[model samples]
Target: MKEVIATHSLDEVGKHPDFGSAQATLRWMLIYMVEETAGHVGDLDTRREVLDSEKG
Candidate 1:
Protein backbone atom coordinates (compact mmCIF):
# COMPACT_ATOMS: atom_id res chain seq x y z
CA MET A 1 0.00 0.00 0.00
CA LYS A 2 2.84 2.37 0.82
CA GLU A 3 4.54 1.59 -2.46
CA VAL A 4 1.33 2.18 -4.41
CA ILE A 5 0.79 5.47 -2.66
CA ALA A 6 4.36 6.55 -3.39
CA THR A 7 3.99 5.73 -7.09
CA HIS A 8 0.61 7.36 -7.69
CA SER A 9 -0.81 10.77 -6.93
CA LEU A 10 -3.48 11.00 -4.21
CA ASP A 11 -5.93 12.42 -6.75
CA GLU A 12 -5.58 9.40 -9.03
CA VAL A 13 -9.01 7.92 -9.68
CA GLY A 14 -9.86 4.26 -10.15
CA LYS A 15 -12.95 2.31 -11.18
CA HIS A 16 -14.58 -0.12 -8.79
CA PRO A 17 -16.50 -2.22 -11.25
CA ASP A 18 -17.15 -4.86 -8.60
CA PHE A 19 -18.94 -2.21 -6.58
CA GLY A 20 -21.44 -1.29 -9.30
CA SER A 21 -19.40 1.14 -11.37
CA ALA A 22 -18.37 3.27 -8.44
CA GLN A 23 -15.28 5.46 -8.72
CA ALA A 24 -12.92 6.66 -6.04
CA THR A 25 -9.71 8.58 -5.74
CA LEU A 26 -6.62 7.11 -4.13
CA ARG A 27 -7.15 9.36 -1.10
CA TRP A 28 -10.70 8.12 -0.59
CA MET A 29 -9.61 4.51 -0.95
CA LEU A 30 -6.93 4.94 1.66
CA ILE A 31 -9.32 6.61 4.06
CA TYR A 32 -11.85 3.82 3.58
CA MET A 33 -9.25 1.15 4.23
CA VAL A 34 -8.11 2.82 7.41
CA GLU A 35 -11.64 3.27 8.70
CA GLU A 36 -12.63 -0.30 7.93
CA THR A 37 -9.55 -1.69 9.62
CA ALA A 38 -10.09 0.44 12.71
CA GLY A 39 -13.69 -0.74 12.97
CA HIS A 40 -12.65 -4.37 12.81
CA VAL A 41 -10.00 -3.82 15.43
CA GLY A 42 -12.53 -2.24 17.75
CA ASP A 43 -14.90 -5.17 17.29
CA LEU A 44 -12.17 -7.64 18.13
CA ASP A 45 -11.22 -5.69 21.23
CA THR A 46 -14.82 -5.71 22.44
CA ARG A 47 -15.07 -9.47 21.91
CA ARG A 48 -11.89 -10.02 23.82
CA GLU A 49 -13.16 -7.96 26.72
CA VAL A 50 -16.39 -9.94 26.87
CA LEU A 51 -14.57 -13.26 26.85
CA ASP A 52 -12.11 -12.18 29.51
CA SER A 53 -14.95 -11.05 31.77
CA GLU A 54 -16.73 -14.37 31.34
CA LYS A 55 -13.55 -16.21 32.31
CA GLY A 56 -13.25 -14.21 35.53
Candidate 2:
Protein backbone atom coordinates (compact mmCIF):
# COMPACT_ATOMS: atom_id res chain seq x y z
CA MET A 1 0.00 0.00 0.00
CA LYS A 2 0.95 3.67 0.46
CA GLU A 3 2.90 2.79 3.60
CA VAL A 4 5.10 0.38 1.71
CA ILE A 5 5.82 2.98 -0.91
CA ALA A 6 6.58 5.63 1.71
CA THR A 7 8.82 3.23 3.64
CA HIS A 8 10.75 2.41 0.50
CA SER A 9 11.12 6.10 -0.32
CA LEU A 10 12.40 6.81 3.19
CA ASP A 11 14.90 3.98 2.95
CA GLU A 12 16.11 5.23 -0.38
CA VAL A 13 16.39 8.81 0.79
CA GLY A 14 18.23 7.86 3.95
CA LYS A 15 20.81 6.11 1.84
CA HIS A 16 21.42 9.12 -0.39
CA PRO A 17 24.26 11.48 0.58
CA ASP A 18 22.12 14.60 0.21
CA PHE A 19 19.47 13.44 2.69
CA GLY A 20 21.74 11.26 4.82
CA SER A 21 21.66 13.67 7.74
CA ALA A 22 20.26 12.10 10.91
CA GLN A 23 18.07 15.11 11.66
CA ALA A 24 16.58 15.12 8.19
CA THR A 25 15.86 11.44 8.33
CA LEU A 26 14.22 11.73 11.72
CA ARG A 27 12.12 14.71 10.63
CA TRP A 28 10.92 13.02 7.47
CA MET A 29 10.18 9.77 9.29
CA LEU A 30 8.10 11.64 11.83
CA ILE A 31 6.16 13.47 9.15
CA TYR A 32 5.57 10.28 7.20
CA MET A 33 4.36 8.48 10.32
CA VAL A 34 1.98 11.31 11.16
CA GLU A 35 0.54 11.34 7.66
CA GLU A 36 0.12 7.58 7.65
CA THR A 37 -1.55 7.59 11.05
CA ALA A 38 -3.91 10.36 9.97
CA GLY A 39 -5.00 8.39 6.96
CA HIS A 40 -5.64 5.32 9.11
CA VAL A 41 -7.55 7.36 11.64
CA GLY A 42 -9.74 8.84 8.93
CA ASP A 43 -10.50 5.40 7.58
CA LEU A 44 -11.30 4.10 11.06
CA ASP A 45 -13.58 7.04 11.72
CA THR A 46 -15.48 6.47 8.51
CA ARG A 47 -15.98 2.81 9.38
CA ARG A 48 -17.08 3.70 12.89
CA GLU A 49 -19.67 6.14 11.55
CA VAL A 50 -21.01 3.53 9.16
CA LEU A 51 -21.27 0.97 11.92
CA ASP A 52 -22.96 3.42 14.22
CA SER A 53 -25.57 4.31 11.62
CA GLU A 54 -26.23 0.66 10.92
CA LYS A 55 -26.76 -0.01 14.58
CA GLY A 56 -29.31 2.80 14.93
Compose the digit string of candidate 2's lDDT tens values, residues 1-52.
Answer: 5675556645343455666564545448668889999999988888988988
- TM-score each candidate: 0.78, 0.52
Clash counts for the predictions, in order: 0, 0
17 Cα displacement, candidate 2 (Å):
14
Query: How high is the lDDT of residue 35 in model 2?
Result: 100
Stretches of candidate 2 above 4 Å error?
1-24, 54-56
True-structure Cα RMSD, model 1: 3.4
User: Whose TM-score is greatest here?
Assistant: 1
Q: State the lDDT of candidate 1 residue by residue for 8-34, as single tens digits.
A: 999998766578666689999999999
lDDT for predicted candidate 1 compared with the true structure: 0.86
